[model samples]
Target chain A: MLLLVLELAGTAVFAASGALAAVRARLDVFGVVVLGMTTALGGGVIRDVLLDVSPPTTLRDWRYLLVPAITSLAVFWYHPQVARLRRAVLLADAAGLGLFTTAGTTTALALGAPVYTACLIGMTTGIGGGALRDVLLREIPMVLRKEIYALAALAGAAVVALGDRLQLPAGPVSVVGSALVITIRVLALWRRWHAPVARGLDG
Target chain B: MLLLVLELAGTAVFAASGALAAVRARLDVFGVVVLGMTTALGGGVIRDVLLDVSPPTTLRDWRYLLVPAITSLAVFWYHPQVARLRRAVLLADAAGLGLFTTAGTTTALALGAPVYTACLIGMTTGIGGGALRDVLLREIPMVLRKEIYALAALAGAAVVALGDRLQLPAGPVSVVGSALVITIRVLALWRRWHAPVARGLDG
Candidate 1:
């Protein structure tokens, strides 16, 4: 029940972000909804596909589908208020990132994936939706170029993997992992942290 | 055997196109190879995942993995010559699109997907790799903005689906379907056909 609630909340916030991006791009209503849903669900779908889950959980579960659709439509109708809450949205996005990374790593471990592969899948789950959104919007993926986004995901995933290896209790381990991700992301944002670019490009 | 050969050839040409793009962007060697492999195998991986094939054929099969890796490396070394052969690469991409569409549709139908779903999946398979490539390079997808790319894939997929419904011979139907895709693509290129953009956005 807790997991379901967290997932739904994550989906809602991600949908809001995607819908806002679509509005900024001046896409029509249909486009806004499509982009929003894609951003909300793309990561989970990719994770499920990698795990060989047919029809994906999101595709089969009406609740999973509904949250993003409703959220996107809501953003479409009341974007001005939502845009004013950009800081709130970013914080929600950070929480979503944390939740998704832990969920993905835990799921992959349960499915008997190797530790390293599970970590990578978890990171992909946290970052994949945003990457897809940027691609559709014709922008460089923020995870690749800006901030400490992907690293935060990776750090959280590694914590999960380490906990699994040490035979730690799954519930507490997951909580810690997700909290670490959220904390790191928030700190990075507050500090304006960025990863280094390649050296000597101009030369 | 023939399918394997054709898929490998398609992978090679697609890798070449991706590598050329990376070179033009002045990405490093690692980035060039990563982009190339992503372009070559992304469509098939996506098709397989949607069809519930575990680990994807491209991921599990050594031959499938080897083809793209080698092709990408070759393109990395010989990009100037490959760029000079741009026309040839375009023609090859048309052929690859046809092959992937037919293969994806056939696979989906064999799995008992609905007809419309199969057609859409086929179109996705045809265009997914190029879309991924463009996304990585931060460009609007060519299928969305340029010539009759996705439409041609859809037409060929429709042909395959139609033939299946009519109980036509599989081998000959596949040939005809792929030929139609290639012909339409080449004609679109030759005649400079383009889909219409949305109107009155300037106002």
Candidate 2:
């Protein structure tokens, strides 16, 4: 299904971004790989736990582990090449954000979560790992600081929910949904769009 | 009840450990406190969310936030004195491990988890935050590597289960359970005990 493709791509890209952050922080190889794995799998693990499913999908499908591990080593070995394409990496991360947010919302709905809780879970699933990672690194999260992060995820999830309510076909809806998210995120990045913080950035 | 007192003490001690780790990781004052709060409260949050309890205890109780924040500041300011009494700190941590494991098991039972699952969850609650904190700091987690960490938690949880079956007085059972955990952990530390890895430390 189109959903599977989007999920796979999104997982790899998100893992790449997390591993990249760990490398930038000068973490060891195992640490880099660990961060990558968690970034790829953390959201889904939280979802399964919330949904009370044992032996979660990530564990059931060990492909989930292998993907991030391979990709992180590739990133680590090709550090110079990756560094030159930092902008491209960010765009891929945006793609990942959109993919994950929509998938999270869809998963919650399938599991019969109420709409509002579904939305919150989707947002948490999209951003929780990155937030945790950034907090540990002692820097403001990239999501917190830049590129209309949560907004883009929220928009994508809302669109997915709307499409489902309209009884749209799963394939076309996923394509359109992901495209919409990627387009919005890329434009936001290009325009340097930022959130309006409390009291006009008075914090 | 005495059991409740021990659980509260364990929470406080674990929060202190998180604050201390943050200090070593060079977090600023507010950051230190938040890290401590997260470490102390995260496992319980996971437990509640898994049990489908909305908003978690940390959000419901003001004390959960206040306790860690105040303790973090106090510990940060008094690290020099605290460091000088390392043995006492270890003893406190061992006692905390038993207390948290027991509390986690009890909560899981209250929520109708099976006995085995309760025990597993109790161990997770006792060690999860520390594991997360280590990963954040880019270090191998001590809970996973050093001492008889999970085993100690397991033993204490077993004691609680046995105590309930025997209808022992809560006060006496808690004291015996805590003392058992501390003794095992202390012995493990004194003897440089480690889990036998299949690969014999090839990492």
Best-matching candidate per TM-score: 1
* Residue lDDT tens for model 2, B123-199: 66676667766766676565534537766887887887677668776557667777888889999888886543222
Q: Which stretches of candidate 2 lie over 4 Å from their true place?
A: A50-56, A194-203, B1-16, B19-82, B85-127, B131-203
What tens digits encode model 1's per-residue C-alpha lDDT throughout B78-111?
Answer: 7667777888889989998988888889888889
lDDT of 2 by residue, A98-177 (tens): 77777787788788887777767777777766765565556677777875778777777777778777878656766676
lDDT of 2: 0.72
The lDDT per prediction is: 0.83, 0.72
Least accurate 10 contiguous residues by lDDT in model 2 chain B? B194-203
lDDT of 1: 0.83
C-alpha TM-score for every candidate: 0.61, 0.61
Best by DockQ: 1
**Pairs clashing in candidate 1?**
none
